[model samples]
Target: MDERLKTNLNLWNAMVPVHVDSKGYRVDKFRSGENHLFPIEREEVGDVRGKSLLHLQCHFGMDTMSWARLGANVTGLDFSEKAIEAACALSAELKIPARFLCSNIYDAPNVLSEKFDVVFTSYGALCWLPDLKKWGAVAAHFVKPGGIFYIAEFHPMTQVMANGGGVAHAGEAKKLELEYSYFSTAMREFPPGPDYSDHSVTLEHGSHEWMYTTAGVVSALLDAGLQIEMLHEHPVCCFQMFPFMVRIEGTRYWRIEGDPIPLTLSIKARKPL
Candidate 1:
C-alpha cells in the first residue's frame, strides 16, 4: 500500500471506536429498529429483501447491518482492520448476521469472490478513493447480472467549497470561506480533533480524501458497463454540510436558504441481464 493510504488506514482504525460511540453514527438507534438508510436512496432502489448486497466503504458496518435488518443478505468491506473488527463485534453482539472483510478496495476481489444482487455505496464514500474508474470497476464487479448498483452522494459542485480551517470571519455570515480551488487534486490534511459524531470530544484522524465532479461519477459508472436506470438530484442534503445551512423539519434534512441548490445527488444503475 502507498504510504498515504497506510496513514489513512491507521487513522480510520483509530477512529472506529469513536465513530461507533458517536451520535452521528447513531448505533443505538440502529439497534432499536431505526434503519440507518436514508429514504432517498432506499425509495429509489426499492426492495432489497432477500437480495445479496455488497457495501463498499462500509464504515464499521452500521449501515450494512441496517440493510440486513431491512432483509438483505449483507457483506461490508472497509480498508481499516479495526473498523472491520469493530463491525464484526457489533454484528455478533447484535446477531445481525452479516459478514465484514478488511481489505483495500483495490484488493477486495482477492479475498472474496461472489457476485451480489445489489452493489451499494453512499454518502462520503467516493471521495476517499482516488480513482473513479477503478472504483466503478470494483462496484460493477460485485453486481450479479441483472442486479442494481446504487449511490447517494454529495454533489461535486458542493465539494468545490472548503469547509475546514475553523472559519473566516464575515460581518453577517461569519463562517468558513473557500480557500482552495473548486476543482483540484489537493488531499486535505486535518489536525487531530473531534470525530464527526461527537465534536465536543477530541480524537485523531490524519486522513486524505479526493473530490470528483458529479458528472465524473456518472461517467465512471457508465464506463464500467452499468446501464443507467434513474438519476436524481435534490435541493436538500441529509447532513449539515455547511455552517450556514438550515435543517428542515419532518424531512430532517438540511437546506441552504437561497434559491435552492443541489446538495446531494443519487444514481441507480443496473447490471445488464
Candidate 2:
C-alpha cells in the first residue's frame, strides 16, 4: 500500500474505539436492533430480502448488519482490523449473522472471490478512496451479472465546504464557505485531528483524500462496464456535513435549509446479464 493509504488505515484504526462509544453512531441503539440505514439508501436500494450483499469500506459493520436485519446475506469489508473485530463481536453478540473482512477496497478482489447479488456502500465512503476508477472496478467485480450496485454518498460539491476548525468557533462558524475546489486534480492532505463521529478525540495520523466531480464518478462506473440505472440528489445529508447545517428535529438528518445545493447523491448501476 502507498504511504498515504497506510496513514489512513492507522487513522481509521484509531477511530474504531471512539466510534463504538460515540452517540452519533448510536452503538447502543444499534445493539437494541435499530436499523442504521437512512431513508435514501432504504428507498433507493429497496427489497434486499433474500439477496447476497457486499458492503465496501464498512466501518464496524453497523450498516452491513442492518442489511442482515433486513434479510440480506451480507459481507462487509474494511481496512481497519479494529473495526472488523468490533463488527465481528457485534454480529456475534447480536446474533446477526454477517461476514466481516479487514481488507482495503483496492485489495478486496485478491482477498475475496464471491460476487454478490448487491454491491452497496454509502455516506462518507467515497472520499477516503484515492482512485475512483479502481473503486468502481472493485464494486463492479463484486456484483453478479444482472445484480445491482448502489451508493449513497455526500455529494462531491458539498465536500468543498470547510468544517469549522475549533469547538469554540464551530457554533459561530455556521456559514457556507468553500475551503476547497470541486475539480481539484490533486489529493488534499489534512492534519491529524478528531474523527467526525466524535470530535472529542484526536487521531494519531492524518489522511490524503481525493476530490471527484459527479461526471468523474459516473465515468468510472461506465468504464467499469456497469450500466447506469439512476442518479438522485437530495438537499439534506445524514450527518452535519457543514457547520451551517441545522438538525431537523425528530429526524436523524441535517440540512442547510434552502441552500439549493445537493448535499447528498445516490446512484444505482447494474451489471448486464
Candidate 3:
C-alpha cells in the first residue's frame, strides 16, 4: 500500500471502535434488528432478496449486514483489519449470514474472485479513493454481466464548502463559502479533529482524501464499459454537513434552508451482458 493509504488505514482502524460505540452508527439498535440503511438506498436498489451483493469500502459491515437482513447473500470488503474483525464478530453474534474480507479497494480483485449481482458503495466512501478510473474498473470487475453497480454518495459540490475554519454561519440564511476548488486534482490533508460520527470524541490521526466532480465520477464508469442508467441529485444529506443545516421532520436527513444546491447524488449503472 502507498504511504497515504496506509495512513488512512490506520485512521480507519482507529475509527471502528469509536464508530461502534457512537450514536451515529447505532450499533445497539442494529444488534436488536434495526437496519442502518436509509430509505434512499433501499428504495433505489430495490428488492435485494436472494441476490448476491458486494459492498466495497464497507466499514465494519453495518450496511452490508443490513442487506443480509433483507435476504441478500452479502460480502463486505474493507481495508481495515480491525473493521473486518468487528464485522465478523457482529455477524456471528447476530446470526446474520455475511462474509467480510479485509483488503484495499484497489486490490480487491486479487482477494475476491467471484462476481456479484449488485455492486454497491455509498456515503463518504468516494473521497478515500485517489483513483476513480481504477475504482470504476474494480467495481465493474465485481459485477456479473448485466448486473447493477450503484452508488449513493455525497455530492462533490458539498466538499467545496467551508465547514468551519473562520467561516461565518448566519443562522438559516448562511451563504455557502467555497473553501476548496471543485476542479482541482489534488489530495487534501485534514488535521486531527472531531470524528464525524461522534463530535465529542477527537481523532488523533489526520488523514488524506481526494475529491471528484460528478462528471469525473460518471466518466470513469462510462470508460469502464458500464451503461449509465440514472443519475439523481438530491437536495438533502444523510447528516448535518453544514452548521446551519436543519434536519427534516421525520427523517434522518438534513437540508439547507431553501434548498439552494444538491447535497448528495445517487447513480445506477449496469454492466453489458
**TM-score per candidate, in order?**
0.91, 0.96, 0.96
Candidate 2 Cα outliers beyond 4 Å, as residue runs = 164-171
Better of 1 and 2 by lDDT: 2
- For model 2, residues 97-131, the per-residue Cα lDDT tens digits are 99999998999999999999999999878878888
Task: Compute the lDDT of residue 233 as modeled in candidate 2.
Answer: 87
lDDT of 1 at 110: 90
Better of 1 and 3 by lDDT: 3
Alpha-carbon runs more than 4 Å astray in model 1:
164-179
Worst 10 residues of 2 by lDDT: 163-172
Tens digits of per-residue lDDT for model 3, 78-159? 9999999999999999999999999999999999999999999999999999999999999999999999999999988988
Which 10 successive residues of model 1 have the least lDDT summed?
Answer: 164-173
Candidate 2 C-alpha error for residue 116, in Å? 0.7
Off by over 4 Å in 3: 164-173
Better of 1 and 2 by TM-score: 2
Task: Using lDDT, rank the candidates from best to worst.
Answer: 3, 2, 1
- How would you encode candidate 1's per-residue C-alpha lDDT over 136-217 as one tens digit per residue? 8989989999998999998776776656321121123534355666667677665566555556666555667787877778
Clashing pairs in 1: none
Model 1, TM vs. native: 0.91
Q: Model 3 Cα displacement at 16 (Å)?
A: 0.6
